[model samples]
Target: MFTIARFLTTALVAILFLATLPVHAQDAAPAEAVAAAPAPEAEAGELDGLENPNIDAATLTLRLIPLTAEELEKLSADWLAIVRASTVDVVDEQIRINNTSAELVEEAARARLTEVTESRRALFDKYSTILDAWELKGGDAAKIAGYRTYRSAIIVEETRNTDWRTLLAQATSWVVSADGGLRVATNVGIVLASFLGLLLLARLVRRTVRHWAGRIPNFSKLLVGFSALAAYWLTLAIGLMVVLAALGVNITPLFALIGGASFILAFAMQQTLGNLASGLMIMVNRPFDEGDSVDIGGVSGTVRDVSIVSTTVITPDNQIVVVPNSSVWGNVITNSTASETRRVDLMFGVSYKTPIARAQAELEKVVRSHALVLSEPEPVVRVNALTDSGVEFILRPWTKSENYWAVYWDLTREVKDALDRAGMEEVEAGAPPVVAPPTGVAAAS
Candidate 1:
């Protein structure tokens, strides 16, 4: 009975402990649920974490948080600053490069321009020196490059007296450029003016020469004409040179070129040049005047014309002959008309049987009694030759140059008439009369 009571007490105690434990656990469940549930502040902190990465700092500085408008403005401001800085840097670099390039170009231009200017100045100085020299030597003013320049005067005189007016007339001035070129415009104008003036002066000279020539009737008209032409040509040439000088043209090169070309031409045309030179010599030397009877190159004739290349002559037979000036100058010239009077020689043949003394006396009387015969040089008749058939008598007489032919013809006819009247038969009855040569001289065996 005691053991059953003890086991029932133990069972009841175990059931009571089980029931108490359930009740305590139920009370703890409420406390644990309450602890696990988050507080409002802690939940707010978690909400802050969603808005900012640092939740604690975000919670501590709530007022410091940026608004949407502030954030946009700050971002825009930063972007604008970066853009402005970049643009400024780029612009500065470009400006620096441009400045450097411009400076280099300016320096180069200055250097080149300076070199050119200096070269021009040097050339100008050289030209000035030449001009100064010209002025020192008595120069004149001339236009060069649209500016007035000094030119030197060169005077040439043909006479002893150095007349300034005459020298000025012959003087010429030249405008020489720095490069040795000559200005031709002024020279042409000067030459034209000078030629016109010289023409007027030449007219005066011609009148004077003509008056003088006319006063001398014996002077040849051809000679006077030639002299006038020569004077005119000389004056024209001199005037041309003076005009060229006045116009400021440099004649050095022109003269040199002309001289060289002339030399070449003279050498090439040697025969022509010789003929022309001889002609000029003849013209100047006056070997024979016009109307003078001359024998040239074995040809005897009266001079009709004297020309540069040839001479024209009219023979006594009325035949015309043209002789080259070269031939006349090269050969001997005989001037028959140079003297006031001339002599005539007559020859006659008579039969050998006739008396020589009687023929001589008769011929002398005929020659002396002739009206044209000159008394200063006495007339003479002489027996010259004894030949095969006859005796030759030579009759000589002096007469005026104009009457030579008339006296010769008249004396020959009168002597023949007198011989015929004297009964001198030309032919004998059985023998041939003493035949004479055509020249009235006895023929030689």
Candidate 2:
């Protein structure tokens, strides 16, 4: 009865101590607050003004119109004033001058700085988003507005009052004007000739860039490919700009539209972009080549081709597998053919009745006699285990990676022949056999 009471008292004390102890965070079991899910990337349903019937298309302000030189100077002055007023250093100086140690005053000043920075960021985002939306979803009305407001808005629309006689006279002039037709022909010929010259120039630029990239020592595939691609695209863009200038067409809208579309598409294709980045890393690092035997991501096969987006591998069973560069880059890659020589580990067991010295000598002799095995790192033969049925021995030999399987197969047959010739009893069938389990290298590259 006394022991039982003492036990109860101990239990009571333990419970009290446990109840008073502070909580600790555990790795496996998390707090309820930690289980909160993250917010989604985008909100569901259409945006506020996008599909609203109340909002007119004309009322949407997509971009600001270009300003004249005088107007631009005044706007620059005003912008400078606003920036000076919002500068954190200036605000902090003013707060220091007030000499207020009150927490509220300090907080107010910090809050003001935050507001200024946040407002500037918000304004930049607002303009970019507006431009993107106008490029993608805006209709004919938005396009007209863009033409009218953008800098170098060169599109001109002719307007006139006309009657039947006036219209007939205009038509007659166009039909009969030989000089006007000659001028038109001349301009067309000049534009065509200029375009041909620009095409040749673009080709020259592409070749030069490719040559320069090729001259770089230890250049990666990604760098070479990107340099060529970028140079070609840049030349094309320049050529387009030249043509537009020659024809008096506006160049701003083309770039603006492309930039906006690229921005929107970037968000939509994030996974693909990630894969591309991974591919770049692979190209730069080059863990495996086109004909390498690699084991990765639970698959063992010979790599057939390594491209930007995916790597193609042919398995031993003649099956083709295409893996994304992202998966390949993010996993451990074992390349068997990476080195010129590979160590082939072999295990053999012998009957306990056999002489350990004679068996070891014979095993080493058999491996050393092999023509393909390298002598620089001599073959190793040693007792590895003493099992219930027999003594296990291991033989390690170095051979050319390409000759690994051939050497293994030959050694297996030769060792069996040599043992048979010597008439020595081998390990019993009940035991792990004299030969280890079958092992194979990757199929021919």
Candidate 3:
């Protein structure tokens, strides 16, 4: 029993010793880690000292040089402090030299400006002498961009050196006053001269165009008129430009305004412009001249008058029609009078038992007998078809365009009459007669 109790006490003591050993081992590990850690700040300081020994001292005495006036103006008070904190080296000698150069450049610019001002003033004085000698009035003086300017009235006195005596007398009596007041008179004279000049130019242009127009052929009257109008417009445009220039109005702005206005007008009247263009094309190309009978866009009529916007036509029914030129230009046009004559086709059918050769001969005779039918083109009578009702024959004959309806009616009636007589004789011999139905009835029925 004593041996067992001693053994248990020794085991208890050994377990307690093992637990305390773990706690001491944890404490010793932390101590060892603390001793092994390096000093990062001290290492950085050592490296910095080795690489640049006088870095801080040099930074304290450093100065920056701005190359331009703008750069110097943009430099804030803190900019120098920030630059001092930076690693980049700035030399004091360079900064001093740049500052001195900028100050000298500013002083030189001021001196040059003063010299230019003096020169401009002398030139202004010379121009003033000329202006004063002219005895000009109703004008003011102004300064622009450091230069003196004398603005004269747009209106000026009208003087005739050749008639100096008369001009002097007129000026003294009516125009000039005791104080030499001729401003109003000069303005009125200029207005009168401009009005008369415009009138004279217009009259001269009209006379010149009329003279040339009379010499041109009647067929070319439209071209001549168009040319004259274009020339007048060109002259007016140039004259307006010259007048604007004389008035000292800037032309560049006017050009933009005109361009914008023209664009708006063109966009607004696109259809009208198309019609006008088409009319011009028709006139120039001579697709169909006046008095010609044509079928245009389902309208069959004789062309009466062709205008820039529309064409006037007189239909065969005596109705007057006005068609837009664009419609005429877009559609196909068939001119009946282009060939002076047209072919008229008439179809007739006889009984199948009726001799085709005999019917063709009779039809040819009827067509040739009509005076409206053209003899140059012989009539053709052909068996077109052996239809269910009877034998069909087509009579093709040429006639003058003006006589188209007349020839067609006359030949049709004559051919039927001749066929009826022949059929009647055949019916009297106990054979059936093939007579066409009444005028307004359907032939097929």
- Per-model clash counts, in order, read 2, 0, 0
Model 3, 1-445: lDDT tens digits are 7455544544443332232111110111222221212222322222222123223422321221211222221221122223323311222322332455443534344333333322322232233222222112212111110111111110011121112222223333322332123533454466567656765675578568856875866534445555566566666667666664553233655787799999999999999999999988887776787788899999999988787788889998999999999999999998877677889987787776888788778778888888888887888889776655677778889988888888888886787788888772121211233465799988783
C-alpha RMSD by candidate, in order: 48.7, 29.0, 35.1
lDDT of 1 by residue, 82-119 (tens): 33344344334334434554435443443333333223
RMSD of 3: 35.1
TM accuracy, model 3: 0.45
1 or 3: which has the higher TM-score?
1
Give the lDDT of residue 408 in candidate 3. Answer: 82
Give all candidates' CA lDDT scores: 0.54, 0.57, 0.53
**Candidate 2 residue-pair clash tally:** 0
- Residue 198's lDDT within candidate 2 is 74
Name the runs in model 2 displaced over 4 angstroms.
1-217, 220-247, 428-445
How high is each candidate's TM-score?
A: 0.51, 0.52, 0.45
Model 3: clashing residue pairs?
none
Give the CA lDDT, 0 to 100, for residue 263 in model 3: 97
